[model samples]
Target: MTSTTERPEVEPARGGTHASGEPADDLLARHRAVAPSWTSLYYEEPLELVSGSGNRVTDSRGRTYLDFFGGILTNMVGYDLPALREAVTKQISRGVVHTSTLYLLRSQVELAEKIARLSKIPDAKVFLTSSGTEANEAALLLAMTYRRSNQVLALRNSYHGRSFATVGITGNRSWSASSFSPLQTTYLQGGYRFRSSFRGMDDDAYVDACVADLRELLAVATAGDVACLIAEPVQGVGGFAVPPDRLLGAYKEVLDETGTLFISDEVQTGWGRTGETFFGIEASGVVPDMLTFAKGLAGGYAIGGVVARGDVMDCLDANGISTFGGNPVATVAANAVLDHVLDHDLQHNAARLGALLKDGLGAAAQRLDLVAEVRGKGLMIGLELVGADGYAPHPAAAAAVLEQARAGGLLIGKGGLHGNVIRIAPPLTLTEDEAREGLGVLLTALEAVDAAQG
Candidate 1:
């Protein structure tokens, strides 16, 4: 006897409407219902991006905007590069997406060799991971184990990543969710200058003051056995806060005396984004003990790694493995990205276009009271929003500008401890035309924000 058991009707997938002609609103409603509360969304009405090509992305409603954020600086060569696509396709045909680090992978070895050659670290060795956070974790582990200390020093208003360990090192309070951490971290001064008490000082005095502060922090805040001092040459999430070009070199002097490892968090500032140097720390004329990188190297694929002095890298005695680290597909994508970055000389383009963008942004700042300062190097620029008081951070103005820019068919990013700085980091492949268009839209947005505030 065949029993007819009726199955209950299944609801549409959470965060998405059913195929029964439901509108996109249902998808958003579902999203709110199922997504984590801390998952932040941009704009008052969050956009649903569906497609992208080159430097532009299309929203669910079919409106296209020039993507200046580059998916938070991860899309190094821009979206859907023909060469990268071809490489990824070829890798996919190989029938192996992932192989645990237990086995050898040809692409991983080639990518590591290329990065080691380019890293500039003496006798460099590379270890791959799935993201910047993991790379930093590895770096921290290597440093602590090598030096046999859990004490670390980081810069104020700096951001590393969101992992438990990385967040412990992050000085940005907004991004840090918990105070509890395994490593004891000491916060130092130097990364953020605009809001510093030493802002009135000349460049030389400022550098000396920052170094003195670092020295004090190391002496007072940390025990005698500090393991490492990690810093972002250009603090990415801290609104691209850039100190004097020689700041890290100055800090390295003190670190050397203490036998502390210096780890440069180049996750955002690597791969020639800064134009003047392939790695941002190179501008300081100091070679870091270890360098952590991610984002741009993989051309939108998940890949991160640490390049360290061979001796330091070998200090980790125990077994460590990242299941998806150095996966075949990601390595291929990264290798292709490196080729494109070098072949096209994107770094030089970044330097050339960055100057034009900065000039335009400076003009906008001069015209608009809302724009307090324009700072950053190469293609990574930041505009700090301020109120009529001239020095007070204007987060509302920043929000207004973001919305205005999006409405004007431009997409950008925001950061800073107070969330008042506009982060404009387009892909390295950004052209003169695209830069001009983005600048025009940004200026218009600034004007709109000023009018709104008034």
Candidate 2:
């Protein structure tokens, strides 16, 4: 018998009403006509998510799915949680929706205080934005504005944002340089041991080698020229790669030696997602001068922010400001998310659930020929798929797996430099049983894809 979890919520599989109470093909055709092709990459026919509550989202076709992707890791609180809705409604009724950094807003102050308290960064100051890319853009601008320098160092395969400044710093040539010229920045390759290009490397050796390469880059990079080094603690889009335990300290020392600011882009890794207090520099016991955040901040309530040390933030205070960056409604939603994560001990849950998922995925990968490896911690996970033959991207197969999983009543995501990595970033509220269900669904999906490929 098919597992209950694998059964689609839509009944009579054919001619069924959608979650939006509309025909699925009609909705898909409308979207295909009105939306950009890029958006349609993930939104094929019969795609219409209409409602969400907790970890399940219902589509227009009345198909409910276990949302292991967590709305691309933004819905940390799941969907329509009463607390978040109430917080947003209260803020809206208060009639304080729009405000700039020039004026002090109550929600702004409260959210700032809560973030500082949670992060434990002394004299932490915040800059609010509308999205993670904007947060990264602001961080890069701030770093550039503060430094008496022109050069910045970023790791290869790292994702910062898409704005000109942040895009210049993003290391992926496929996503970045192919469309734009390199800005005033240099790329220093750094990441995990699995398939790392750097040779003669162990954990310590990787750090030492990266540090040496950075020193050389600095020497030729014009002293007082490199402004900052931005990196993710655990690589998310880069195949959920985790660095060696020693890379953080070693790189921080290199920055210290060069008097360069260190920026931690925690947009994808922050909140309770990593089973930590905050996706701050403290994860690796290294303190960054600046940190960028978004995604899980407002629990899918449209908020992003930056936390910087006093000295670094002072630079922004002296030279810059924003409008509508810290709208009261968004901040209130952010406060509610912070409260919910704390009150429910979501961080601990993330840690426990992550362990369960990772172990299960590892075993599944070992039993499956299509899977190359499994990596990630906490709720952030990735499964790298090996090519069936030549070195071509297996996007077709990956899409097949995603489609099969969707049909099986699970919502998953795709990632990696090649789009072949199955990303499993669920809400922090995910339970062990939910993880098991998702894993089983994904395993069955993989088998279907393999069989189709054969």
RMSD of each: 2.9, 7.9
User: Clashes per prediction?
Assistant: 1, 7
lDDT of 2 by residue, 350-399 (tens): 99988888888788777676777788878988877766653345777778
Which whole-number lDDT from 0 to 100 does residue 58 have in model 1? 84
Q: Number of the top candidate by TM-score?
A: 1
For model 1, the stretches where C-alpha displacement exceeds 4 angstroms are 1-25
lDDT of 1 at 44: 92
lDDT for 334 in candidate 1 is 95
lDDT values of the candidates?
0.90, 0.78
TM-score of each: 0.95, 0.90
Candidate 2: residue 161 lDDT (0-100)? 73
Show pairs that collide, candidate 2. 18-60, 18-61, 18-62, 19-60, 19-61, 19-62, 20-60
